[model samples]
Target chain A: MSATESPASTPLLAVNNIEVIYDHVILVLKGVSLAVPEGGIVALLGANGAGKTTTLKAVSNLLGAERGDVTKGAIHFRGERVDQLTPAELVRRGVVQVMEGRHCFAHLSIEENLLTGAYTQALSRSELRDALERVYHYFPRLKERRASQAGYTSGGEQQMCAIGRAIMARPAMILLDEPSMGLAPQIVEQIFEIVKDLNVRERISFLLAEQNTMVALRYADFGYILENGRVVMEGSAQALGSNEDVKEFYLGLASEGRKSFRDARSYRRRKRWLA
Target chain B: MELIFFFEVLVGGLLAGIMYSLVALGFVLIYKASGVFNFAQGAMVFFAALAFVSFQSWGWPFPLALLAALATMIVVALATERVVLRKLVNQPPITLFMATIGLTFVLEGLAQLIFGTDVHRLELGIPDDPLEIQGMLISTFDLIAAGVAALLVVALGVFFQYTRVGRALRAVADDHQAALSIGIPLQHIWAIVWAVAGFVALVAGLLWGARLGVQFALTLVALKALPVLILGGFTSVPGAIVGGLIIGASEKLAEVYVGPFVGGGIENWFAYVLALGFLLVRPEGLFGERHIDRV
Candidate 1:
């Protein structure tokens, strides 16, 4: 089914042509839209300042906190119009976001940081313990350093903690932003493996905003490429991964071979999709 | 004999320091959760005390009066969150601080307008009689107040460390945007913190009212908490306690030991002087989190 027609199936989350403006003047997102199917991983691929984070924040209803407002369009989660709901209300409805840069509570222990995710759940003691064990099962490194302050943990561990913390919320969907940012390639691959595992086992959907296009396209079921606050191109992961333009512009691969810095700088000005 | 006298002064100062911690605790709660240095905390103390006394004067029973006053503080907290803070989300911290300074005046004015300016003596049935222990005298009222403060500190400590809501509060304190994205309701957390701060204000109000009478001057006691916050770190509960104790003991000791040479009344300014010196040495305070930027 086409992206437009998929909304009739009531996908997990649907962002319909939303426009976001910050400070009521600076327009950040213009007529951007995407959908994450239930139990599917969708990648929001873009360079920096391409409105990937803004789109995720729009779906999570977190833009308001940063003086950004959705000036137009609607966001539906599980067929309910949730554009106006508070972020906590959205979480209660099983939508949580792992913000970029591993925003772990520095002073709190890893366990405490995870527990904060379950704040709205009101789980019993045993249930809470079960949730922690479940998260630890996926990220054993977190289990080993559960008592340590999150600030002192390594970059990869903090990323795991951020995702683990979201898992503790028992969310139906998680808006994962920049999970691969600043992490080594091996660590990024490991995180994607756990994310795929969680998707398969727990049936959790993910709308991931990632600048690491090559790795994200490898794992995501579908992908949308955003540029200058607009979706320029979108397709199944296989299609986007193999597309020549995507390989040239994003992965630095050309018809001949890997492009040098001079050729790559000129490649952006020759984006056929923008034309 | 001299040693015995010094111990008495030290003990007295320590107990009085607990009172300062009580008021400072309210400031810490609001500051930690919202990053707003609530200048209105002093006014909240005065307002709660005045409300309690006013309710009692209306022929309500003591427990009933206390409950009503507690409810009033909760209302004040909710209103403040809804009206003032809800409008100022994402504003700079200085803007919020300035708003609270405006709030302080409004609360003080409202308290006077509602409860009248009359100074009413609050009798909590705790006698002010001195109890002697090995030739050193201690006030029974001070002992009971210190005990109450200790109980409060323990209860607050448990609430913060052991509860789900407590974890959310700390998370929000660390980062607002992240907390919100994770579905920790920023508004609810702010309201809860303010309500808890209001509750702390009530306890402090009642105790200070009984000791010094419920009057306009009771608002000035919040100034004493300033030195306590400076010493303990504005974000740490134990810091408030230790800060208060040091400020209390040294000030009293300074008044007694150094008063003859300096012509007395050094007790009032000694805490500030010490806090200033402390600021130069450790600006973050003893328990305040040291901010380290990783570049």
Candidate 2:
């Protein structure tokens, strides 16, 4: 893992002090910043409505579709500013996003869904087949259910198909939002393992938003915790996982003896980071 | 002799249904891509046919006039995507539908202003004279028009199934945000779909104009597509064809067999009644995809 990490040079992607507003009125993200090193797996940890998804969408320029705009600061990919680029332009520059809730093309078959991901690439027939083979190599389950409709597939398979579709784009960096949403624990493990394999083997970088702090820190090299559209805490994964505040608040590991409901309620109100 | 006459009406009505299918095809193409029920399709048909005739009156040949009319429709399509739809992205479906309604009036008024409201005769050179086949009479023009519609449907099917743009179109139809995230330019896709829909409108316009003089009434022919769409499903290409045939054949058959008792002119309302009944039972139509949400 250390060999894969470069020494504080230009990171693969950098989100610097950015703010997001939706519908030209409601503010969603406020002065959040983070970075993903080359060939690294970085996690954005936050509860629902914490702006993790917004940050990822801001990087991919998908915020525009939802009437959200990155109004402040800038995003840089490989030392070049890219916050103004369209989503398709961003994809052409090798950044793709797998949306939350596995937005698979429901009417299409699994293989067709995967093929749609390669729309930006103009590959020959043999090259297209080779790309499909590469994706299937990473996700053998996708191969087994290639003929089935994506909507009919299990949650885990749909999630895999979503990731497999992203892989078909051959992206340098992927913005993954909540890969473990509504899936079994074992399935989450399997997916994280595949994500790790892709990171190491394909040298692809990941900026994943996750609510599962313990599971995310177990796999991610670095993590950032967001609260109410703000980056409240960020650190190395080990430091965050072992930190007393994170362990107590995010991981549900209170250092004191077992407490009543009132004590737990008061404990949340007294978040140390906010203080 | 009675049986032979019956076969003639059946075949003629079926061919006429193909014309309705042509108009419905335009609606389906735009709806599938952008989820907009384009009410302006009728006006487009009127506009294209009028443009073609007006161009021909200025001494352009048949092929040149046709090309010029097609170009006009393409321009209209591109302009609509840019001026109207681009600004309305992610809007509710009803809002888009209302916008198309506004577009209908704009197209109708603009076409009349440019081409004048006087009805013009359009002759495609396909003679409407009856031809005897297997001891039954059929109009050659209807036969030719049906053949053209069949060819267009086949070409569209191949385009949607085999091309990258077609795959991207389906993806866009399924989910716009997801399609964008995967790098499919929503604007480009919208422009392409509207252009294709425009092309379809042009073809329908030319054929219908040739059948029933290039007049403002040509726009009413799009109303005939409404029944076809209700019976065939709004999203399926094949559904349009099949629904058109059923509506066509059944209405003619009802006019011949059931009209005398009802004092005639049942043909216009027969399709609507059938469509209404179909809505009660199989609202999705034969090939329309039924959305099954897993709670």
Candidate 3:
């Protein structure tokens, strides 16, 4: 199918062969492609410096803020071209990106932070209230501490606040960047559970970028492994989980279930991805 | 007689502080929303007062002149946002500060050219005679100024707490990018904030001009308000009021008691000395948020 036209089964969001460059000369993402199906969760898995954030920013059209641009590519939301829209316009069309850091307004109370998320919707008073209630339902801790300044909240609560604020947008899809960063393992599990619940129950789609490869693979329907601004591997969660190469490099697993430290250091056989 | 003299001077100083608070409130409003420490605020006060006096002298009624002056402020706000701030959106704080400094000179020159360099006596017809309350005299003008400042503060507080735009302002203050990501137009918010600061300048100018004629020196009063911002934290509304009160009251009391010892100019630097000392102990000022370092 053409870039503009998609059949009924086409994904909710598709990033087609996008190349992003920063400050005119520094190329960040080289022809990255990903698709997020309707009401489905997808993971862009990468370690540090893997252009995961660049890819997410490319899709959300937030690269402009950093003087970055998509030199060549098309981003489609619901099969409609959205490469030209500003970040605010993209938000109004129900696509919101939660920035990597839990960038809650440290001065604003948690409730105020959530209220700002619902700002563009122009919802009636009751609708605004309902949206707040929906976010509170997902994050009961946020509701309890709604009046406290976001800066005073714990790392986990701040993460919840960031996600809750995105939820308040009542978005059809969310571009969540590193939800697991700076959170405890249990907190990460709880957050992923919430993402799963939102996808299954509310039918809200998610495009999550995570460095926690195992956790991402655990929850995401499909996964893409990004390395040096390129997608090296893409498959279903189960297939990737069982893939031998993925096991050795990403999952910290060798054929014998785990690699000893000395063996890992000595066994640098030059993986195909590096080549 | 001695007790009454002290009491009279004390009340007068408190009233004068309210005018300073009014000017500082203008600075606080813009700084809170856009993080720009607007040096042009004092000049805007001068401009607003000049515009008002000019409008009235041009055969306009008092209320009509007031509306025209306010309209001018709003226009200046929109223009500043479009011409200056738009180009300097992601600029460093120092750049924005320097821009406002440049804006200060431009406004002063414009006010002089447009409204004439001559000082004009502003008589608003409000009774200025001192009233004797139990043998203590209090000027009616001071009382009126106090009442008006209080009213505006309360009204601004209520508006900020209840209005939708007000909530957006708080959000913008929180994080500009976050605010933009959530669909709040940063430019529109900055424009609205500047316009509100302009409104504050009008009220400050009108009253100060009435007390001390509409002239170039009228802008100097805003300079006196800098210590108020220092004491109250540039981000706090009530901090301006309370800081003004402290500055106003302490200066008068010190001038009375310590003027002879210091050769009678203690009021000139009393507020600044106090602010400097207070800030030394607590850098954030009375109402400013304590810095929280994030990892």
Each model's DockQ score: 0.78, 0.82, 0.66
- Provide chain B TM-scores across all predictions: 0.99, 0.98, 0.97
Residue-wise lDDT of candidate 1 within B158-191, one digit each (tens)? 9999998888899999889889878888888999
Taken over the whole model, the C-alpha lDDT of each candidate is 0.92, 0.91, 0.87
lDDT of candidate 2 over A28-80, digit per residue (tens): 99888888988989999988898999999999999888899999998889889
Candidate 3 chain A has its poorest 10 consecutive residues by lDDT at: A1-10
Q: Sort all candidates by TM-score, best to worst.
A: 1, 2, 3
For model 3, residues B37-85, the per-residue Cα lDDT tens digits are 9999999999999999999999899999999999999999999999899
Better of 1 and 2 by DockQ: 2
TM-score list, all predictions = 0.97, 0.97, 0.94
Best by DockQ: 2
Q: Write the per-residue lDDT of candidate 3 for residues A170-272, one digit (tens) a residue.
A: 7898899999989899999999999899888889998899989899999988888888788877888889889987888787878887877776655543443
On DockQ, who's better, 1 or 3? 1
Residue-by-residue lDDT tens digits, candidate 1, A11-77:
8888888999999999998888788899999999989999999999988888888889999988988
lDDT at B203, model 2 = 94
Error of 1 at B291 (Å): 2.4
